[model samples]
Target: MKTALCIGGTRFVGRHTVEELLAHDYDVTTFTRGIHDDPFADRAGVSHIPGDRTDRDALESAAAEVAPSVVIDFCAYHPREVKTATEVFVDARYVYVSSGSAYARPDVPMRENGTPIHDCTPEQATDDSAESYGPRKAEGDRAVAVAAVEGVEAMAVRPMLVYGPHDYTERFAYWVGRVAEYDRVLVPGDGGSLLHRSYVEDVARALRIVAEEGEPGEAYNVADRNAFSLSESLELVADALDTEVDVVGASERELAAVGLEPADFPLYTPRPMLVSTEKLASLGWESTPKADAVAATATAHVENGRDGAENGPARKDEEKVLEAMEETSA
Candidate 1:
């Protein structure tokens, strides 16, 4: 059996990727801070090492003790985090879960070679702002890409706006919940913009496949092959719930007046975040059906009691915006 060490394997993508690994019969060890409870702690084939990735000594000690054949990281945000990890696990094949935001100002379907990447050192930012987050992540991926070690392979798997069950972000769930709660919905910008999102389980599977079959020094974008427009996305969510809601298009200024920023809402981008998955498909990886993923998310919203129509504190603001939008259009 192949020995796998998963850094930060107790959370959303980490947990799901571990499950996928276990299903493949890989001998797995999970590394976490012992803060969040691990749902799979009792699974017979799994083991755990308690430590913080930010703590170089703690992570180095774990890496030496585990001596895994493969290392998949889930919580490497800073380049320092991945740089230390690469140094410690120099002999292991590495797979880092990077984000699509690493692409610099992508306006079309972002291919592995498609866009100008955010080639920045994290130290340049000095602060973790919205602008810095992508560059920081890009630096982390670059850390693995430029490793000087011989006979070692590392690849970056970039996923765009991952969503599914246990999504604490509540961005996508907010939309599903909105459809369940109200008859009319305030959609921004006529719903013509494209949003690329990957289901958690699908991304998890892609990580496993890439780890097994991906080429070293390569990066793959793990996302749905087809890009869904905002309108198509909302329709899929509503169809999964078997309901129809009126969609009112609102301008950003109008939404801002009611305290709803487009950035605050889920999948609210004006630019197309399309990604070409040709590299991933070339590896013979298959993702779950988009409809199945959508249905599962819609079902999760209802079953998890997260299907509230309003965005908690922003509920009144949303309603006010809707009422004012109606008044203006009438």
Candidate 2:
């Protein structure tokens, strides 16, 4: 069986990535702290390796044992962490799960080459952090590009606003949930803020492609080329829920006033950062139609009791995190 090591494979895109890997018949071993309950920690064809990414010694010992054919790092925030992981697993192909946010100031219809600088703010990336999130992540991408991993091909995939089942971020789901209840949906900033969306499954599929067919040292934008504005996304959700919701625009400043961070939105936009996926498409990767993705998201929201505002499927662990966030803010 083909062996794959998925670091940080228990949530969001990572969870979907693991499921996709397993479906493809890869012998999957997931490395996480198992801090909370994992739905698949006990499944057949998968092994759970408990370790901390920040702890190099623990990671190295684990990597030595797995000796996987491919390594996908899904939760790497610091470039150094990636360097450590790559250095230890010198024989495995590395697929770095990066963010479109790494493109600090991308031009319209963002291409991988257009991200000019590592321009994340100090607040976002912090000191001891050389690059901001975008730039820092880009730097990590570059490190993996020339990785010393013998016979190990490395590639980076930058996905934007990944959403689907099991999303606790509730960023996209918030809009879906809110609109399912309130007739007026408030949008933070001009509705025209162009952005990209990728269904979680599409992102998982792209990662598999990178493992199977991606070119070494290549950075591909894994985005839905025909991205929608924040307004359009809201409209899609409204339609999916069979509900009519008014779109009320609020400035970023206004959002901050309410103590809500704009970055928290699933349809993220500090500025216009639309992406072009012609490169990935040429590689035969395509995102799900936005309408279908939206509908699925809406369906999940409805099943979770979002339409009624007091009900929805509750995954206990995710609910704890959401509750903590709300409590802290309160």
- The candidate that wins on TM-score is 1
lDDT of 1 by residue, 214-283 (tens): 8877889988877677677778888899999787677889987867667666777767788888899899
TM-score of 1: 0.91
Model 2 regions more than 4 Å off: 119-131, 148-151, 188-190, 249-270, 305-330
Whole-model lDDT for model 1 versus the true structure?
Answer: 0.81
After superposing all C-alphas onto the true structure, candidate 1 shows an RMSD in angstroms of: 2.3
Candidate 2 C-alpha lDDT tens digits along 1-330: 999999888877888888999999999988998885777867998898998888999888877888898889987887777777778777778888888877756687777866564644436443454345676787777667777344557788888767787787676776687677667655556677776778898999999888888887777778765777878887998888788877766555555554555565556567777787888887888888889888898888679754422222222322343444457669
Off by over 4 Å in 1: 148-150, 253-261, 307-313, 328-330
TM-score of each model, in listed order:
0.91, 0.81
CA lDDT of each candidate? Answer: 0.81, 0.75
